[model samples]
Target: MTRRTLHAIRHVGFEDLGSFETPLRTAGYQIEYIDAAERDLGQLEPLAADLLVILGGPIGVYDHDSYPLVADELQLLRARLAADRPTLGICLGAQLMAAALGARVYPGPAKEIGWSTLDLAPSAKSQPLAALRDVAVLHWHGDTFDLPQGCTLLASTPLCRHQAFARGPNLLGLQFHPEVRGDRFEHWLLGHASELATSGLNPVTLRHDAKRYARTLEQAGTVMLNDWLAKLKH
Candidate 1:
């Protein structure tokens, strides 16, 4: 059988696949990355691959001025969602999906930049995220998006309402870092150092927090990605 393709739209280098890398390959996917920040997305076909994963980034989906490619990404998302194709969005990517679907993506009341547990909605308990029950996912974004019309709200935290959403069986969106790899937790610390320092948070504190949560998050993230991909296979 030919290997399935998992094409990822990456905004930043450090925020690449993470735990999703191994799970995807093990599921017979050959990963290809598209750097959204470096290239023009005008000629890109969003649903050209078997699975399209829009990875998280530090920038906002609404930051079209700074990242003009976001406009192209939105156009791509519109096509993907219209086809009910398999697409996964993380953090800023999730916000982009919402915006593409005509939902409001804006700054939240407060920054939620730490490990936090989600309040699982009853309908969400039976989906791909079933493996992440009681899991404290890494939350690192200050922006949130309204649930797109006709989309199912899957999970939420105290600071954000639309932490996760799913539309039909093909599309899933996560606002948390369930795809982060624990062994490479150092990359996250170094990659986002300025944000931590600006927030008056210490790197030492993040190291300790990583020790407590990163391992478990990695394991759960693997299971969750596999589960979601399995759903796509069916």
Candidate 2:
């Protein structure tokens, strides 16, 4: 059997695949990790894989000067979006997608962190996000983006207006971390220690909430990602 390639553009190490990796491997995708933040991205080509997934990170998409790879990544995303290639974005990745599509990406009213539920928009209820209805996934970012033109608003929170967006069957962007797992959440706590302290969030409370809600995401996230991958197959 031939395996499809899944190129994951990773920003930081700890915020890796989490729950999403196993499913992709089981579904017969050969995963490739590219550390775009630290490595050079100038030579990266467009539509390089069957599936392209952009993972979350601490830096903003606007910080292209500090992180020059951001520009190259956005250029790649623009080409992918224009071609309608299969792509998925989580958190920072989602914000990058928005920026690549000519939308404004900026800081929101507050840093939204912890396990929180998104209020699904009416039109968003018909698709795979239906699996996340009432599901409180991990929320770990402060930056937000405007809804890109011609994109469907999938989910929202009180802190962030544009939590998830979908453009056709090929592109999906999510602000929250549905791919986060309870078992590995400690990595996030350790990884973003300064961000947590500055944001005035309690690690104990986040741990408690992760214990309570991460299981919900475990089931719902699987359903959501599987449904999405299935769509790509068709």
Candidate 3:
């Protein structure tokens, strides 16, 4: 039997693959990462993957002038969606996915910087994201996406309407950080302390709640990861 391949695109130095790496490794998928900040994405193709996970980053999707790789990465994502392969985009990755699909990505009402509850859309009750009904996920984004044509809006919060969306059977974009765990969250909080001040959120408060939310978030991530894998099997 052939092992599945998972292409993981990393956008920054600190944003490494977190909890999602475990299940993919356990399931015998070959995980390969391309660092978008340092590497040229034009030479990198999104093909040969049973799954593709575009991880989160500190940069905005529209900041292509500073991060020139953004355009090529978006183009690659567009091609992947056209091929109809299994793809998951988290946070900034989700915004890029939305932009590639012809949906506008712009600043949201306010930066959602900590744990917040997301209400599942009525239609999501029958889909893989149904597990998210009234659940709180780690949110750290300031940008949100408009629902792309033909895609189902799965989850939302007061701050962002397009919290999560699914395109057909195998594509998902989540604006929140479902893949973050204790250590990873700590790293992010410590690394991006300056941004917390800009967003009017206290990093100390986020750290205080990190320990409290870790276990629950991990459990929720497991459920979501299992659901994503199940969808890929079809």
Q: Which stretches of candidate 3 lie over 4 Å from their true place?
A: none
Model 3, residue 103: distance off in Å is 0.4
User: Tens digit of lDDT per residue, candidate 2, span 1-234?
Assistant: 469998899999988888899998988899999897666776777777999999999999989999788899899999988999899999999999999999999999989998888999997877789999988889988899999999999899988889999998889999999999899989989999898898888999999999999988988998899988888842
lDDT for each residue of candidate 1 in 1-234, tens digit (9 for 90 to 100): 459888799988999998888878888889999998677787887668888999998888878898788899999999988888899999988998899889999999988888767898988878878788888788999899989999999999887988999988788989988988777888989999999989887878777888898888889888888778777742
lDDT of 3 at 89: 92
Task: Evaluate all candidate structures by whole-model CA lDDT and list the values in order.
Answer: 0.86, 0.90, 0.82
Q: How high is each candidate's TM-score?
A: 0.96, 0.97, 0.94
Worst 10 residues of 3 by lDDT: 128-137
Report the error of model 3 at residue 194, Å: 1.0
Question: What does candidate 3's lDDT look like per residue over 93-186, in tens digits?
Answer: 8898888889999888888888877888897877767665555678988888799888999888887888999887788998998888887777
Worst 10 residues of 1 by lDDT: 225-234
The alpha-carbon lDDT assigned to residue 141 of candidate 3 equals 83
